[model samples]
Structure formats: C-alpha cells, structure tokens
Target: MKAAALLFIICVHLVSGGSHSLQYFYTGVTRGINFPEFTDVGLVDGEQFVYYDSNTRRYVPKVDWIKNNIEPEYWTRVTQIAQGHEANFKANVGIAMQRFNQSGGIHTFQSMYGCEWDDETGATDGYEQYGYDGADFISLDLKSTSYVAPVPQAVITKQKKDGVAAEFMKNYLTQICVDWLKKYVQYGKSSLERKVPPQVSLLQTDPSSPVVCHATGFYPDKVMISWQKDGQDLHEDVDVGETLSNHDGTFQKRAELKVTPVERKKNQFTCLVEHKSGDPIHMILTEEKIRTNSAGNNLPVIIAGLVVAALVLIAVVVMVVKRRSGIHTAHDET
Candidate 1:
C-alpha cells in the first residue's frame, strides 16, 4: 500500500515445467499514472516468453525460441485478443473507480491466469484470479462452474457475469493454454531442461542483521536453499525466500538466519544450495566469508509471498463476491 494507492506486489511471473505451467498476466492502470494503460505478459515454465504493452500496441516475443518458432498468425491472434481485453479492462477500471467512489489516485486492475500440466500423466489443472487495488476481486469455482468474489463490492459482478468467465477460463486452461504450454516446452526444451549451478554467497548488513544465504544463476527454477548448524538442519529464525527469475531466465533464491556473534562462534553454520544442474554448493559461514553491506534495499521484495496449499500450485488470493451491486460490471477475460 502506498499513500492512498494500492501498490501491487510486482511479481515476476512464475510458471512450471515437466509437469509444465503457463501463466498469462494482464494489468490495467488508472489514467494519469504515466504507467502503461494496459500490459500483458505470458510465461511458460517460469520463463517469460511474450510481452505486450499499450505503447507497443503489438504482441512481441520476449525469447528467441518463441520468436523463431511461433507463426505470425499466432501473434496476430494474440494481439487481437489482447487488444479487446485492453479496451474492456480500461473501461471496467473506470466503472469500478466510479463504483468505489474513488477519485484522484492511481488504481490498478490486475489478472493472473495460470495452468499446470503433468506431461507424464497428462493431468491438467489451473487457476484464474483478478485483483483491484491490491485486493482479491474475483476467482473461479470449476466444480460449480461459476465465478466467486470474496469481497462485497464484487458480488454484483458475480451474479451478472457468472458462468461466461468461468466457462471461458475452463476451456482456456484445459485446452488453449495447455496446448500452448506444450509447444513452449517443445520449443525451449534445451534451455528449459538444462541445469546450471547456483553461485552461493553469505551476506550480512551488520552483525545485528540476519546472516543471508544468497543463491544466484540456477536453472530450471527448482533449487533447495537451507541452513545447517553443527551438522544439523536449522529451521528456526530462518526466513527462506521463494525463487525469483533473473533477467537471463535463470533463478535466484535466499534464506536468512538471525544469530548473534556468540552463537556464530560457538556453532558451525553452513548454507547449502542444491540444484539439478550440478552438485550441491556448501558455503560455510565464517567471518571472512560473510560479506557485510549496509544497503538493505538492494534486495527488495517485489512479489507477494503468497503460498498455495492445493493439488495444483500457487494461486493468488481470491475474494468472494459481496451482495450484488444492482448494475452488472462486465469484467473482460484476456
């Protein structure tokens, strides 16, 4: 939250592989914010593939494989669909602002659509969620085949725009999204499947601050980062972070352990990073190895640390539709 505006937890898209995932993210912002009116990003297996923004007005591939392999017609179709969604999203944001009786501030309307597929078993499932001003706006209930809004303001939308969004999402997640995901996996097989070892480091801003285990440049987005004290796994006072993508499509993660000088001297602390790309890296926590810096803002928490407890995967928090608002607010699907 930032000064009367909802500061979104700007997430780098998370996708899956093997067992692959496809994620489509769309964001529409209030006018006068100078941000893009609409932006869309698509990711497969945690790698960003495509991007589109109001300025470009065209769907562009973010990766070489996607650019070289995908047909122009596919891009054209995606652009057209995204254009339509942009129009509707902008309008919806405006209407929503009016309904909320809001004025003179930057507001955002965001949507995340994700799909998960297990290649071996062909098992497929996914989730679709939307948010307004940092709060869960709406979500889908595949079992009942209806839309649900956890918030009071969105209830009107749930009633009037019920099955249409759910049906489209269901079809998209099962058919269109999954089909594209398979192609993405096929196109980027070499890079997606390749393993790269992580560069591990021990960091600390000051002795009073927590000891940080920073792992960088790992591939496949799957890696284990943990701390060991005296040859035993140490779980307490540790703040382990989720994996995040680097600009080059590699992944990085960190875990923090709080300790005092006395504890550090008495115990042998080691940071371990295990990745499929290579052997596990062990960095023993020694005074000489712990790099100290005063800059805490260097590592910013860009995305929400939302964890999903489900058979599928991580999902954005969902809101229930409050009572119906008389007028049906049309939320467009991208």
Candidate 2:
C-alpha cells in the first residue's frame, strides 16, 4: 500500500510538470519571444529556442494552443493580398459599367463581396464577403448586384455610336437581304429564261384608266411590282417605277397599270408585289361596274333558300286542303 501511494504521487507530479511546460511555451511564443526547450535549464530570457519537431513538421505551442496557433503576420499578409485583388476587380467592373452606360448598352453592377454605390441613383448595395476559417475558405453572396447605368458619356462622345447602332441594325437587315437575294436574284438566275413578270391590280379600279400601287415598309429597295391575269403571268401590261429609299433607310415602291375596260369588268386581274425573299404578296381590285356572278359560287346559300321556299309552299297547300276537307265533312253532317 505504501509503494502504490508513492507511485500515485509521482504520476501526479509528472502530469503537473508537463502542463506547466506547455503553458510557458504557449505564452512566450505568442508574445513574439523565443520558446525554450522542455529541459530543466532555468527559463532563459530573450534567447530564441526552436520548439518545433523537424521530423513531424509540427510546432509545439508555447502559448495558449488556440491563441498562438495563428500568427499575426500571417493574417496581415492575407489581408494585404485580398485588398489588392479587390482593388483590381473593382476597377475592371467600373470600366465596363462606364462603357455600357455611355453607349446606351445594358450593363449592371453587383457587389461580390463589399458595398457598391450607384452613381446614377445614389443607392448603396452590399454583398456577401468571403472569409477563411482555420481549415477552409468559402465565398459568400453569390448574387449579382442590381445597379444599372445609362450609356456613359465616353460611348456617346465617340463617333462610333451611329456605326454601332448600324451594326446592330445590320443583323435584321442582313437576314432580309439574304432571303431576298436567294429568292429573287438566285432563283431568277436559275430559271431557264428570264422574263419580266406583269403586274395586275386586284383592287377595284377603272380598266380605262391607270391604277396606282404604292409600297410602304422597312425595305423599299427590295420590292418588285407585277400584274397577273387569270393566273397567267403578264409582262407588257404592267409598268413598274423605281424604288426610292427614305431618310430613315426604309424604301417606297410604286407601279401603274392600264387595263381594258372589259378586263376590269371580268375581275380577272391581280396586283402582286414580289419581295426579295420570294414571298409574293398581292392586293385585289374590282371595278364597281362589274356585276358579281353568284350562280355557282353560292350553291349552299341557293339550296338553303330553295328549301325554305318549298317548306312555305307546302304549309300553304296543307292549310287549303284541310279547310276544304272540313267544309265537305260539315256539309255531309248537315
């Protein structure tokens, strides 16, 4: 029992001594002072001692383990690097915003980490800032900020605004041109023989006088005027005028056709404007003097009218027959 008591006291002494060693080293290292070896050489002041294990690549904490683990210099370096990167990122975003605002293009600014100020509306915005924990790092606030600016002065002051708008407009015009060139020019060239198609106006007009056809829309230069009669293409009977481009870059086309009075009365003529895209659109004109033939064209309506007339006639005949029979029966009873 005495031996066991002696052993227990020794164990307690060793534990206490080990704890004291760790505490002294943790305190000194955190104060930027050198750590001392765990050996019993009386605590030396101002002497740098390496307490790191070279084989294990681990440092022994001389101060509180949590407090001394992160060096102040390490955090300082990290802060400096982050600030520099943030500056560059903000500068690029600012330049892009300035360009888009001046040119009337769409561009919006958003904060990935810090607060952003809207120069237009004077609003402040904040986004999530990223941070590093002891073991891992993560990004916050993944959403885009909501400050949009008008086109900047730099974009407007440059002579290229018209050119840029034109370039943007070109996409729409190019599509039209490609379709037109394919249908009219390409298809025309592929035909066995080139012929100037006639222009017929289907709208009501006097055959003895010239009928005027006007064109209006975005593309004026790409329009062709022609006339057709009884589904056959005509050439000499139609006169097409030059297409004129307007100040807004749109076009206007006109054509005139003179037909015989008999042709107008027959309602056999149609006016066709062939677009560059090979899509032919038309307008029909009829003369007021022409009597419309409803004979075979209104078969269902004629049948319905005949059926109603027959039903009314049958009702009248039945009423007369019943009246006569009632008189004969009454005379027989008297």
Predicted structure with the largest lDDT when compared to the true one: 1
> Per-residue lDDT tens digits of candidate 1, residues 62-156?
88988888778877777776676678777767766776788758777777777788898889887777777767777777777788888777787
lDDT of 1: 0.69
The local distance difference test score of each candidate is: 0.69, 0.30
- Candidate 2 lDDT over 207-245, as tens digits, reads 355665555442313456777777776776678754432
Off by over 4 Å in 1: 3-17, 32-34, 294-334
Model 1 earns a TM-score of 0.83
| CA lDDT, candidate 1, residue 235 | 93
Give the range of the ten consecutive residues with the poorest summed lDDT in model 1: 305-314
